[model samples]
Target: SDVIEFPSSIGKVTFTHKAHQELLKDCQKCHASPAGGTIAGFDKDWAHKTCKGCHVEMKKGPVSCKECHKK
Candidate 1:
């Protein structure tokens, strides 16, 4: 999917899958297998650590709550 939306109490987190794929150029970065399937232990904390962490490290993505969690 181009955009993956995660609904939460705060707001809906809109993930731009296509954009990440274009930059990373490797599905395994987020996917468990090259085939691309569900992440074994995907959750909020994991996303915050992995996704947000990547954004922080790369300094090229949304890191704030309002930036990601849209109402």
Candidate 2:
């Protein structure tokens, strides 16, 4: 799917796969090695670390609670 929604207690996080693919152009960045399938350890901390960490490093994307976790 182009867009994936993650339901959370704080809010629903809507992720645009196509956008990231176009921007990063690397499946390994978010996927597993060798083939790009399910992530190894996916969880809240992992998301905050990998996803938000990337945003922080790249100086783009949402990095705040309200920015990602919408009510």
Total backbone clashes of candidate 2, pairs 3 or more residues apart or in separate chains: 0
Off by over 4 Å in 1: none
Worst window of 10 by summed lDDT in candidate 1: 28-37
TM-scores, all models, native as reference: 0.93, 0.90
Best candidate, lDDT: 1
Kindly list the per-residue Cα lDDT of model 1 for residues 10-31, writing each as its tens digit. Answer: 9999988888899899998888
TM-score of model 2 relative to the true fold?
A: 0.90
The Cα local distance difference test for each model comes to 0.92, 0.87
For each candidate in turn, give its C-alpha RMSD to the true structure in angstroms. Answer: 0.8, 1.2
Top TM-score: which candidate number? 1
Clashes of each: 0, 0
The global Cα lDDT (0 to 1) of model 2 is 0.87
lDDT by residue for model 2 over 20-46, one digit each (tens)?
A: 888898888988773666677788899
